[model samples]
Target: MTQSATWDYIRGSDKDGYAIAIATNNTVYESREVDPATALGLTFRHAFSLSDNLLLRSSLSAVHDQTWSRRSDALIWRERLDYDIGPLRLFTSVDTKVTTLNERNIFALGSFLPYPESFVTLSVLPGVLYRLSFGEIGVSLTASRTMFRFETDYLGLRRNNDRVQPNLFASATFWGIKVEGSLSYARVTFPAGDFDNLQRLLYTAKATIPLELFRLPIEKLTLELSSGRTLEDTTLPFSVINVSTLSDARLVAKFNPSHALTVFARRKDDEYVGLGARAVTTSLGAEYAYTFDGGLTAIVAGSWRYTQETGNIPVSSLNLQLGLSKRIDFSRTTTADASRATPAAPTTTR
Candidate 1:
């Protein structure tokens, strides 16, 4: 048996546009199969308005974990600067991270075994956005580099590997429809002479559409479709390149027949690629909720899913759930009362 506990604390200052968060997680194992572990994480973020047209923001995080025979530590930091001029905005950001893993125990049956490893990553992104009459369009370019090292006892040395990636992304929204796309290329090099260099390419695209029903109980409908593909090429002599494709699509509709009753339905499809294989899954789900006075609410949900894969038997499953919840409002003002008392913000004027 195992037990775990977690605690989180966050403090933010709206006047200064700064925030800090800290979290701790501890787990203990009772059985002989596993060991206990504890992890602590902290994050700090701040934003500064340099001028009426310029803004700067930065964030940093650190995490440390100690397990039976393994210890892990990581640190990440990012900074961004943005400047806006009329309908156009320009921004640039840099992110960097380092992670280290160490292991103390080497020989144990069914025990935690860790390999000493170190990883470092750095990324830079620059982008520009232009506001249109109806919506907005943005384009960004990213360059990233990562290095990984592993200590080997046999060679009494550490093996090094590195990868470099360059990516381009674009997004736009117009006429109640949103579209986003990205393309990335990566080159990986190994210095340990165990494997040859490799190259990989990835492409992804997504689109979202929202619809409103005027005369029906249905309030809104949202449809989303996305697809991605990855291609890999090896640098070894006479090595063949391989390509994998994945797709995901989902649709959701919401209905409110009465003030106290709400209903929703969703359909989703997902495709995953494996080694020379592909698997697909389709699911449909519906949920209904009813709220009564005295903070009582009841919900009923159902879902059905089907999965298919090459050279495997097709599988299907159905699930149904019922739940009830009670709300205890400790505040003197209710949500509706608060909304009525607070005035809306004024709109911007040109």
Candidate 2:
């Protein structure tokens, strides 16, 4: 069983050219196979609009996890800058994370071994886009490096790893059908150790089609299909759970019968390179949400899924969940109102 809560507060509006936000998330988990655990996260974000066409945003986050009678912590920082001209836009971002793990004994089994006691990873991406009549085309280059030190030899792992990749992507919409595709080449270098330098090419394409385009009665139904390896997220949350690191091809369909309800079905084929395993999963789910007069919102969701994996027995399961979310603005005053209320400086002595 797990219980979670989140609080978020914002002090200003992006339209005002400056804003700040603070948020916290806490979760408690109980399990029969493992000891109880608690996880806490705190984040701060700021946005500055230097000009109408220029923007700068930054965020800092810290996460602490208490489990197995040990505490693990991670700190992350990210910064981004963007500027645009008449038909061109340029942007750059930097992300960094430092993590300290103390759970080596917890995973004594065959589970993928955890990282070194401490590690740091940094990545930078800079890209440019050209707005086209139908959509846009862009190119981006990403470079990242990881460094770590281990007290004892665990898996013959090295202390240094680096990767560089350049990607080309484009998206366009035609007759109610939207399509997108990207191609990238990645080169990775590892210090003389357990692994050798390697290179690979990656590609992904997706398309979304609405039933209305075919004059079908179900105007709210839409289908989407995609295949490819997405960019990796280097955040603490994802890193802790070791999720979303697989490449998959997926097909999904969604239908909305009402303003507050939605239904969806999905099928995905996953490829786990590290484990040399492949799996297929299918699921159906629905979600409903309603807001009260006092601004509080309640949400309920449920799903049933089945999975088949190589060298493992097929399994199926059902899940139900409930959650609550709300956003509060501490600064109710608008920029224009604040400016007007500042009674013009006392008129110069006549």
Report lDDT per candidate. 0.58, 0.62
Measured over all alpha carbons after superposition, the RMSD of each candidate to the real structure, in angstroms, is: 9.6, 9.4
TM accuracy, model 1: 0.55
- Return the TM-score for each candidate structure: 0.55, 0.69
Model 1 C-alpha lDDT per residue in residues 125-196, reported as the tens digit of each score: 888888777556676766666556544432243334465656666678878899888887866665664445
Task: Candidate 1: list runs displaced more than 4 Å.
Answer: 1-16, 19-44, 61-75, 100-112, 134-139, 149-159, 191-193, 213-215, 228-246, 256-350
Q: For model 2, how does the per-residue alpha-carbon lDDT over 185-289 read when each residue is reduced to its tens digit?
A: 877676654445656677778888766655544435566666675433121211221112223232323232222554666676655333445568787877665
- How well does model 2 score by local distance difference test? 0.62
Backbone clashes under 3 angstroms, per model: 0, 0
In Å, residue 55's CA in model 2 sits off its true spot by: 2.4
Look at candidate 1 and tell me the lDDT of residue 97: 87
Among these predicted structures, which one has the highest lDDT? 2
